[model samples]
Target: MEIVASVTNASKQYKTGDTVITALQPTTCEFKKNELTLIIGPSGSGKTTLLSLLGCVIFPTRGEVTICNQRIDGLKQKELANVRLKNIGFVFQSFNLLAPLNALENVMQPLLLLGISSKEAKQRAEEALRKVNMENRMLNLPKMLSGGQQQRVAIARALVTNPSLMLCDEPTAALDIKSVAVVMEELKVLSTTGKSVAVVTHDLRLKQFADRIIYVNNGVASENPTEEELFH
Candidate 1:
């Protein structure tokens, strides 16, 4: 498989007045094209830290990060923002949809922000909603929908950007079993489109759908873990 993004000897550290904390250990890893990869670990084990670095949201303190073979760790803030807008889509755990907007409106916001016309944004947003089986809920407000429904809308919003990489953080943490299954299956389908899908999840129930499992612990990254290591 082709590598969509990679970190080479990358690590992150935070410095206080007199103390330094290592959020992630030096490690090299690749996120492959058209694959569903899970980064699993206990809380505070640097799973999200690695995601942020790979997504170009935060630069690594040491080493290099590349997406599609372009080095990004040394990029300026403006350049980084451009890269993220063009290549990365984020799905937050909180389902951060605006309460005032209906489902279609929520999904179109990002496209509009990217300077797409209202008509075109609406068209693309509608198609994205259809992908997640959410077209019927396009007119419903967040308060009127179930948690699963809201998450589907969030997924539609992420897809509207046509991003090469989807960085999902705790996507199923608050979802019920039924909802988790629906969302995971939907996510699995997305991986067939030649995009890179990386999920940071604590839910072991979703591991069966992953093509690769990356275990993060105490700022370390272990790739291709056995099923036993992932679930137990």
Candidate 2:
């Protein structure tokens, strides 16, 4: 398998006046193509911080973050943004769709930001929606779609970019059982198609879909956690 993204001895810290808080400890991990890796932990467990590091949303205070084999920890903000645009896709718990835009338009937003022409963006967005079984609802607004349908559209938006790595945060948190199954199945299938899928989630039901699991707690991360470490 090929590594699409990785963090080596990466750690994060925040300064609040005279106080310094550590969000993540120095840790190393890799996310590979054609695999689904789950980052699981309880609330305030540093999983989200780990995800943010992989997503290039923040610079690691120490160590390195590589996406598509490019070292991004030292890049300027504009350069980091460009890297994210070209190599990464993000899915949030809140769907993050535009209330006023229809599904197709929402999916097209990323391509449009990349300066792709409307015609090309539309064609690609349609294909992405089709992949997630949302082609029929392309014209519906977020307000008009069910929670599951909206999530599918969000997936399409992420897929439209054809990114090497997909980072999802609490993707199934807001979903019901059926919707969770549908979303997780979609992500699992995507991984098999040669994209690295990393999800930060609390939902244990998603474990069945994972090819690998990363457990995090108290700012520490382990690639292979023990049963006691995972539950205690």
Candidate 3:
């Protein structure tokens, strides 16, 4: 499979007066295209930080990040923003939809910002909703939907852009088993459609769907042991 993202000796540190906290230690990893990988770790283990760096939301204090063969770490803010807008799709744990907009409108926001005509954006948005099997809820506002329904809309929004990579942070954390299964199924289908999908999750129930698993501890990551390791 093609490599979608590569990180080498990446680290992030924050200063607090005389003290400095290293949020992420030197780490190297790569995510492959059309794979669903899980980054599993406890809180404050740099899971979200790693996702931020991968998505170009925040630059690493040291080392390099290459996405799709491009050296993204050294790019200017404007260039990074453009890269993210075009190549990265984000699904937050808290379904970040606009309360004022209905499901369809929320899904169209990205296409709209990309300069697509409103009519075209709406048509594509409907198609995305259909992909998530949420076409019937397209006219409903976020307030009118359940947690799983809202997340389905968020997934549709992320997929509508046809991004090269999708970053999901604790997507199943706030959900029950039924909702988690629903969301994971949608994510699996989304990954099958050719996008590299990476999720930072603590739910072991979702591990079976991952092509690869990275277990993070104390701000560092390592390849997780197989299911045999859990029972042995």
lDDT of 3 by residue, 62-159 (tens): 99998778899778999999888888999999999999999999999999999999999999999999999999999999999999899999999998
Can you rank all candidates by lDDT, best first? 2, 1, 3
Clashing pairs in 3: none
Estimate the overall C-alpha local distance difference test score of candidate 2: 0.93
Model 2, residue 219: distance off in Å is 0.7
Q: Report the poorest 10 consecutive residues by lDDT, candidate 2.
A: 223-232
Which regions of candidate 2 are displaced past 4 Å? none
Task: Give the alpha carbon lDDT tens digit for every residue of 52-119 in model 2.
Answer: 99999999999999999999977999999999999899999999999999999999999999999999
Winning model by TM-score: 2
Show how many residue pairs clash in every candidate, following the order shown.
0, 0, 0
Model 1, 1-232: lDDT tens digits are 8999999999999899999999999979999889999999889989999999988988899999998778996678998988888888888889999999999999999999899999999999999999999989899999999888899899989889998898999999878989989988888899889889999987777789899889998999999777676666
Q: What is the lDDT of every predicted structure here?
A: 0.91, 0.93, 0.89
